[model samples]
Target: MNINKYTKTDLYKIANNLLWTWDFEVRELFKKIDSEKWETTVNNPIKLLDEIDETEVVKLFNDNDFLSLFEKVNHKLDDYLKNKSWYAKNLNTEKDLKIAYFSAEFGLTECIRIYSGGLGVLSGDHLKSASDLGLPLVGVGLLYSNGYFQQKLDKDGWQNEFYIIEDFNKLPIELQLDENKKPIIVKIKIADEIISIQVWKLIIGRIELYLLDTDIKPNSKKNREITETLYGGDIETRI
Candidate 1:
């Protein structure tokens, strides 16, 4: 975890924040720094920051225009997180009412490919629409390591499948951290045995999407593979 010395500020935080996923301007700022790598990594800011040359980041840090834009974007994010929206201000129902959305897969974006088909696409659209409407929605889903296989046409026009192994650390998602900045682990009972699930958070504009991953070291090998692929098991396993 040796970060470059030049990243002294909260540059990683601002870049990894899911706000940039929706804000094209802020996303473009990161892309401007490294366009080639940006496209290669599916516009992943965390990956961009990690892989970009140290000298390039240093130059951007010293650039007044980049700094100005960075500060403004950070300020706007602070406001967005702290302030209440129209939905909160004008709500007439119970204040404690909350919506919990559950789906087998969610297609938030193609970059974070935890989706397989139309169901995930529809679920993603629902969350996006919910965010736009300022609804009190929380999404729950499993984090897949190798998301749905990417389809490609071979030279003979036959179908070829390519599965991508995603490095979660390089994505915009964040591990739910406790007061001491350690990952918060949640334990639950399934069947007759207990299992541990690590929670990862993805901020979808106004809403927060939480994905549970069973790929931690504490889990058994069988359990660790639960989140390995999308729709990749038998009927019982799928259930």
Candidate 2:
């Protein structure tokens, strides 16, 4: 099993594939449908009365828009595959052992909102790469009620903050559900004290991530609300 960081060549190849002149061919039906939708957005903001007829829909193909959308989708798929491979390489050894991967980062591949920097992206890569390789690794992470804040500093040392919100349920992830189909909760010893934790499950495309929280009913308000802020807080806290 090969395991290492993605090299410059890998990066360049990805870029080249993205920039290639040849695009995925769009089916006539899809082209027609997409064109009609584009026309509706460009011309009719209110979508009054189905302005474009079926016949007109067929003629509405905007080649550039179609190509752009196709490329973006392909890029996303490519990224997922690459990340899946990384995960497979790192943790797929014990086939029969039920394994769960806990990480706080889990970048855009899991949720667009958790991107604090390269760390989340790296964690996402691990999850994706593991999934792609069919590694028996299940991902566990945190979903923010509020997205991570990335601080950017200017030359004058002024800090600028930006937020990325995460919708975990939308991301590809699975959960150990109770009989009611809700995420299963667990009890742990934190600081020599018993604490209960509730988990939230998310689906990140084809990836699976579970988020941990201590805000469940059984826990007291003194339990610190745990969620992804800079992305690694969960793993760090748990460890």
Candidate of highest TM-score: 1
Q: Give the C-alpha miss distance for residue 133 in model 2, angstroms.
A: 1.5
**Candidate 1 lDDT by residue in tens digits, 1-239:** 22323462467767755667667777877877778988987877777788867677778868777767777877777777677776777883777889999999998766888998899989988887777667888999999999889989999999999888998987878899999998889998878767798899988777889999988878888788788889876675577
Cα lDDT listed for each candidate: 0.80, 0.50
Top model by lDDT, which number? 1
For candidate 2, the lDDT comes to 0.50
Error of 2 at 108 (Å): 2.8
TM-score of each: 0.84, 0.49
lDDT string, candidate 2, 99-210, tens digits: 5887666664222465566877787777655555656666777656566675799999999987654433433333468999876888988777677777765543344566
Find the 10 residues in a row with the least total lDDT in model 2: 14-23
List candidate 1 stretches off by more than 4 Å.
1-8, 177-183
